[model samples]
Target: MKLYPIESGNFKLDGGAMFGVVPKPLWQRTNPADANNMIDIAARCLLIEDGDRLILIDTGMGNKQSEKFFGYYYLWGDHSIDKSLAAHGFHRDDITDVFMTHLHFDHCGGSVQWNKNRTGYEPAFKNAHFWSNADHWKWATEPNRRERASFLKENILPMEESGQLKFTGLPENHILENSALGFDIFFADGHTDKQMIPMIHYKGKTICFMADLLPTVGHLPMPFVMGYDTRPLLTLDEKELFLNKAADQELFLFLEHDAHNEIITVKHTEKGVRLKDTFTTQEIFN
Candidate 1:
């Protein structure tokens, strides 16, 4: 199996929102903010090429939203899914599965796009089966007031409307091993309901797709949870458990939202689990 880090796009978000109650004085050291208090963010997706299946983990926020809508996020950078795919000698059509960690616009928005006529939305990857779990599908479709803004209908619904949506089985425990996508899925809830973190066994190491569970190295501290998370307390528990295990097992964390740090590993520090080392996808994959 081969894995490629797909650079979907980059944007800036309020550092305060990204780091929750954690004071700027602390988080700013690792994730320095600009004059506007915005921090650089990346929509880093993962592509898996295994035998006949080419599975994409997440497609960054697509370009279908209006300028006014995107103005809030302060989008940046020249990287795009198309350009990144081309660099790897592939295209969206070659993708057989699009496994989303969650339904947030920034994560799964690129799964659907405007049709040629611009009359309506259509599946971005014509040949790919969009993946989500039954629990998350329901939660996202019927979002609560707090998360309603992040779960946009335009970014979703089209996959099911196109008859290409598929659901992964929810595990009874924290993990579902040997999933249909050919990896173990670690179910996390603190960030959102049924947020599936893919634990992929590749190249003699476990490369975990750390979705919002651990956005950036700045979020390594125990209390550094996102304000967007509905259950911040639960997030603390989940992160402690996951990070401890990650440190013990020496898992290579494939960060999806960290614009600068691509892959990282943690080790047990006196202050608890802390960043041990960092690596680019090329360094680890090649």
Candidate 2:
């Protein structure tokens, strides 16, 4: 199996929102914000080549958003989703599966794109079977008020409209129980309803895609939850349990939103779980 780190681009998000109750004084050291209190974050995606399956996890924010919409996020960076995939000798159509961790614009916006003269939206990967669990699919499609702005119809509806959208069943039996994609869908509700965190069995280790659960290396601490989370108290409990298991099993967390760090390992310290070390996905196979 081969894994490629596909960097869609970088964008700015309010640091206060990213670091919940954690004061600016604490988060500023790790990710300094501008005068507007916006911090840069990487919308990194993952592409896995396992035999005949070419699976892509997340799509990052696409280019369809209006200038006014993008003015807030400030989508800066030269790397694009297509460019990053081409770096590994792949293309959009070459992807067989698009495993979306969630349907937030930054995570799955690139799943669709403009057809001709920006008339209609079309699945970005015409041949790929777009993957999302039934529960999460419903949650994202029928988003609540707090998350409605983040779940854009342009980023999602096209897949189902194109007849390429399929979902892994909810209440998945024993993880991979007839899942649409290959990996086990570990569900967590702290960030969003039934967010599917892929537990990929790759290269002799379990690599967990730390979606919003662990947005960045700085979010390793239990209290460093995102304000975007619907339930911050639940996030703390989930993080503690999740981090302890990660430390126990020595798993490499593949970070999606971390600007600088790609992957990291955690260790149980007297002061609670702390980052043990950092490494790239390429370093893991080596």
Candidate 3:
């Protein structure tokens, strides 16, 4: 199996919203913000080439939104899925599965795109089966007021409309066994209902995709949780348990939202789980 870091693009998000109650002085040290207090954010996606299946985890926010709509996020960078795929000698048609961690715009917005005539939306990956659990699908489709803005219909509805949307077993099941993809998904509810974090066993290493569970090295501390999380206390407990186990097992964490640090590992310190090391995908995987 081979894994590639597909950087779709970069954008800026309010540091305060990203860090929650963590003081600006503390988070700024790791993810320094701009003059307007917005920090750099990356729509980093993962591509898995396992045998006949090419699985894509999280399609970063696509370029279909209007300028006014994207103005809020302060989009930046030239890296795109097409360019990244071409670098790997692959194309969007090669994708057999689109495993979404959640349905947030920044995470799964690229799943659908405007058609040729701009008449309506269509599945971005024409040959892929979009993977999303029943619970998350419902939660995103019928979003609550707090999360409604993040779950855009243009980013989601087309998956099902295309007749390629598939559920990965029951959301309650801790591990959704996808033997074909060579990964068992671990579900977390704190970030959003039924957020599936893929636990991939590759090349004698277990690579856990840290999709919002641990955004960056700055979020290593137990108290540093995102304000966007619906249940912050649950996130604290989940992070504690997940990090401790990850440290004990010496697992590699593949960060999604961290613009600078690609991958990181945690260690058990007196202050609880802390960043041990950070490396790019090539540095470790290659």
Candidate 4:
């Protein structure tokens, strides 16, 4: 199996909301924000080439939204879905599976694209089976007030409409076996309902996609949970359990939102879960 980081690009998000109760001074050091207090975040997706399947995880925010719609996030950088796919000798249609961690726009927007006529939408991956649990799919389709803005119908509805949407077993199962990503998916509910964090065992090393569970190294502490999480206390429990497990197994955490750090490992220091060491993506794969 081979894994490639498909960096779609970087975008800005409110640092305060991202860092939760953590003070700006602390988070700003790792994820420096702009004048408007919006920190740059990488819409970093992962591509897995396992056996005969080429799977893409969490398509970045696609370029379909209107200028006014994208104005809010301030998307930047030259990296794009097409460019990144080409870098790995793949294309949009090459994807056999679109493994969404969740259905938020930034996470799944790139799964569909604006059609040539610019009149409507179509599946970005023409031949891919998009995967998300049944419960999360339902929750995103009928989004609540807080998440309604994030779960755009245009970015989601097209999957089912295309007849390629499939569920990943039961909602209660945190550990999903035989994932399309070719890893064991550990589910977390705090971030959003049934968000799957892919725990991959490559060679003798374990690499985990820390989705929004731990957005940046700044979020290493349990309490630095995102304000966007539905249940912050549940996040605390999830983080406590997950991090400890990662530490015990020596898993390298691949940060999905951190603008700089690609991967890190943590330890149970006197100050709680502190970063033990850091490494680049190449260091692990090389």
Task: Report every candidate's CA lDDT.
Answer: 0.95, 0.87, 0.90, 0.88
**Highest TM-score, which number?**
1
* Candidate 1 lDDT tens digits, 33-66: 9999999999999999999999999999989999
- What TM-score, over all chains together, does every model reach? 0.99, 0.96, 0.97, 0.97
Give the lDDT of residue 230 in candidate 3.
Answer: 96
Model 3, runs deviating above 4 Å: 171-173, 177-180
**What lDDT would candidate 3 get against the real structure?**
0.90
Tens-digit per-residue lDDT, 1-286, candidate 2: 8788999999999999999889999988888899889988999898889999999999999888889998989878798989999988998889999999899998999999999878899998989999887888888889999999999999999999999988887763324543566666667789998787888888789888888989998888788999999988978887887889899999889999988889999999999999999998789845
Return whichever of 1 and 2 wins on lDDT.
Answer: 1
Off by over 4 Å in 2: 172-178
Query: Could you give me the TM-score of model 2 versus the true structure?
Result: 0.96
Tell me the alpha-carbon RMSD of every candidate: 0.6, 1.6, 1.2, 1.3
Candidate 1: deviation at residue 39, Å?
Answer: 0.3
Candidate order by lDDT, decreasing, is 1, 3, 4, 2
- Candidate 4: global Cα-lDDT? 0.88
Which should have the higher TM-score, number 3 or number 4? 3
Give the clashing residue pairs of candidate 1, or none: none
